[model samples]
Target: MSDHHIIDAKKMMITLEDVNKWYGQFHVLKNINLRVKPGERIVLCGPSGSGKSTTIRCINHLEEHQQGRIVVDGTELNDDLRNIERVRTEVGMVFQHFNLFPHLTVLQNCTLAPCWVRKMPKKEAEELAMHYLKRVRIAEHAHKFPGQLSGGQQQRVAIARSLCMKPKIMLFDEPTSALDPEMVKEVLDTMIGLAEEGMTMLCVTHEMGFARTVADRVILWIAGKSSKKRHRWSSSPHRNQQGPGSFYLR
Candidate 1:
């Protein structure tokens, strides 16, 4: 519980300052810095291996940064297990693949985390899970196994599962990449609805159409670093002057 503020911690939901990471001898992230305000939707886009996924991964301490600071909801990340757990409780993540339990039904999968991690009662967790499932339009399939659902439906379930935690910030690491072409839109539509509701999100994706529709800012990650050029669509009247794909440099 480090109270030391890096950048008006009261106003920013997430802050990463001079963050750096390495895998063995290879430097995976270089001096990464970012600040996200509550309710802001940010898109991180770039080619493969550009550190887009790594950045969001570090936020929740899934992949710890070897250097610099990461603060989420005023909790600075460190070796302190309590601080890490606190941040994880406030941030929910949706991955590229739908990592659901094959043995559990959709409702069960969604309720497990809340029951175990959040110490919620089983009945209460199930109620919360169903609330989010309906929000994602997948409540009717709540009793189905993950394998029984379509890719889009499962991904929507994944999103709902994350929402069950009642997180203040959501991180999406190319959530639609593993979906079929026809399924991508359904997942994106669910995400768009989340954006409209003012959920604070940081997403990594190449879907320019989704970015154009919901992103308050688009950041380009290149070669382990975020590009200097950023597109701030919310305040820029010329945001649409160029095509969606033209917003970020390749």
Candidate 2:
């Protein structure tokens, strides 16, 4: 057990080195460098214009970087399609809008990639799908479509969909920002359960309470470039942090 925890601490899953991103001339991330350990829950907070979401998107190449490099699960993000495909498969992502295939049933949404991309048998893929659905507390909704569920339930299905890919790391871009007040807890509870099960997660959110309670490290991104300087947020010791227009981690 001791060795297990140690392994979790020492395992490095994602590394960003001097990463800079620009939308034409508007530079988003400025020389950003971050290293995340396996099983570490990282929360990123900032104002709306800040590059928090952009940084998370860069990890999965959802938004291609204008400069620097991102490495996930030991493979570098390069021009090679194989490398991109491999990194994407290992790094699962959950969007705020719960981008599900409303036309397909939940079971189809979960098993499609595994059966096609991983080339697993349908029965085997479904077993994995059912396991993750249970993990996210949405097993009973398996046959339903995305439109048939509540926002929170849809998000849970989205999470289960990601887990179907069997990722080594999970990246959440504002997981709960879009839900109603009451639905937030369900999504949070799902995340907490995953944390307890030892999944590595990096999130971009403004929910200070969730960050303080569940995060091992807090990363803050500046709203934009600062006097042409880059601000770096790292994994700090468990200390309470707060700021005016600044991202805090507890």
Writing each residue's lDDT as its tens digit, candidate 1 over 131-220 gives 999999999999999999999999999999999999999999999999899999999999999998999999999898888888777888
Which residue pairs in candidate 2 collide?
none
Evaluate residue 142 in candidate 2 and report its C-alpha lDDT on the 0 to 100 scale: 97
The regions of model 2 sitting more than 4 angstroms off are: 1-11, 224-250
- What lDDT score belongs to each candidate, Candidate 1 first? 0.89, 0.81
In candidate 1, list every pair of residues with a backbone clash: none
108-226: candidate 2 lDDT, tens digit per residue: 99999999999999999999999999988989999999999999999999999999999989999998989998999999989878876889999888776777667776676676432
Question: For every model shown, what is its TM-score relative to the native structure?
Answer: 0.91, 0.86
Error of 2 at 74 (Å): 1.0
